[model samples]
Target: MPPYVPRPIVVDYEEACRIRDLSPKASATLSRRCLQGMIRDFHGVREGTLAKEIEKIKDKIDPVTWDSIEAVRKIGNIGAHMEKDINVIVDVEPEEAGLLIGLIESLIEDWYIARQQRAERHAAIQALAAQKEAARKAGPTQGAGAAQPNP
Candidate 1:
């Protein structure tokens, strides 16, 4: 089955990867946007900047995952807000930009796709159990001499 990435998130991530080699800066910017959107959509965090939102949910996610998220935020910020006067031109290498895209893909799979698959499995199990139960209930009455034979 296809992965469960949201349409908007998919669009950004795809665009980011598409231009990763030619335009690392733009890729990083899109990656940052994708990360922000994922946090909002998956974790239901809708406040402050990406960094602040991540900080709010630091305890909810694994420490390693949290750190990765912060890294992307910092790098993306540099790419997004280049300042000429400050002379802050952070270079986003193609490999680094690829990592950002990778992180987004992982988040989509881990958070959205896995949850959805689990829910579907749970529902299927429940349905099968219900069917078996109904069949068991009917079996006792329909067999042998439990009821009068039809003429």
Candidate 2:
């Protein structure tokens, strides 16, 4: 995970990874919570359930990415919410949990890391533009061997 990610999100994601093999359900739940935190923190969509929050950002993201986010939400939902019949146990396979974790990794890269990179690039462009503008304002310099104009 990138160092810029918030500590709480990193903690949840790390915990999810730690238990993915031993307890897929717990891992999925943690991943789901981590996803929700990302949505709320990054996208500024904090008004409703994870599903609704995802819906709010549907247009903001590409269809494929939106679908992937929805998939994570559904799989994580299995661990988060109980079935109507309490006797039934719907298990999330280790592989599925791993996929959720992978999606989170992608999102962190797509959203946070990409945003930081974009900011840096923009700042660089702005700095160069300022340098050019300052140079233009300073007027053209005379060659060292050029003759001087009389006052």
Candidate 3:
């Protein structure tokens, strides 16, 4: 629903700054403190829902995708609690955050893609099932056991 986890990085960044002895510098595109606030809500990710739904359609997806989503979810937690150098909590240089950003992005992408594919597969299953039922009822029209050529 939201992003991944509900908390934003900005809040933690600010807390980090307080713990560390650094002030927001001029060149940093995002000070962890303020940047976290900008992150979208990520708490509503329904792991239970996803897990249950995925179980029904796992065969239609790339396993790697599922793994990526899981990794992103775990990393999100780590990033939330990440410590910067000097406890700023540690420095998350732009380049470093960039890598993490990539992971997060990939994770989100995989999650959505998997979900869509799963939905499609589910619909297909229902359609096939319905067709089979219809066929079953229309059977034996001209089989060997049919009425004796209507005499």
Q: lDDT values of the candidates?
A: 0.87, 0.93, 0.43
The parts of candidate 2 lying over 4 Å away from their true place are: 142-151
The clash numbers for all candidates, in the given order, read: 0, 0, 16
Better of 1 and 2 by TM-score: 2
User: What clash pairs does model 2 have?
Assistant: none
Rate residue 116 of model 2 by lDDT. 92
Task: List the candidates' TM-scores in order.
Answer: 0.87, 0.89, 0.37
- Give candidate 3 misplaced runs (Cα > 4 Å): 1-91, 140-151
Clashes of 1: 0
Candidate 3, residue 61: the lDDT equals 44
By TM-score, the best candidate is 2
Mind giving the per-residue lDDT tens digits that candidate 2 earns over 10-121? Answer: 9999999999999999999999999999999999898779999999999999999999999889889899999999998999999989999999999999999999999999
Query: Between candidates 2 and 3, which one is better according to lDDT?
Result: 2
Best by lDDT: 2
RMSD of 3: 11.6
Worst 10 residues of 2 by lDDT: 139-148
lDDT of 3 by residue, 1-151 (tens): 2333224543443344343324222112223222223222322323344334334444554787556444433333334455455355434344444444454444335554455677789999999999989977987567566755665
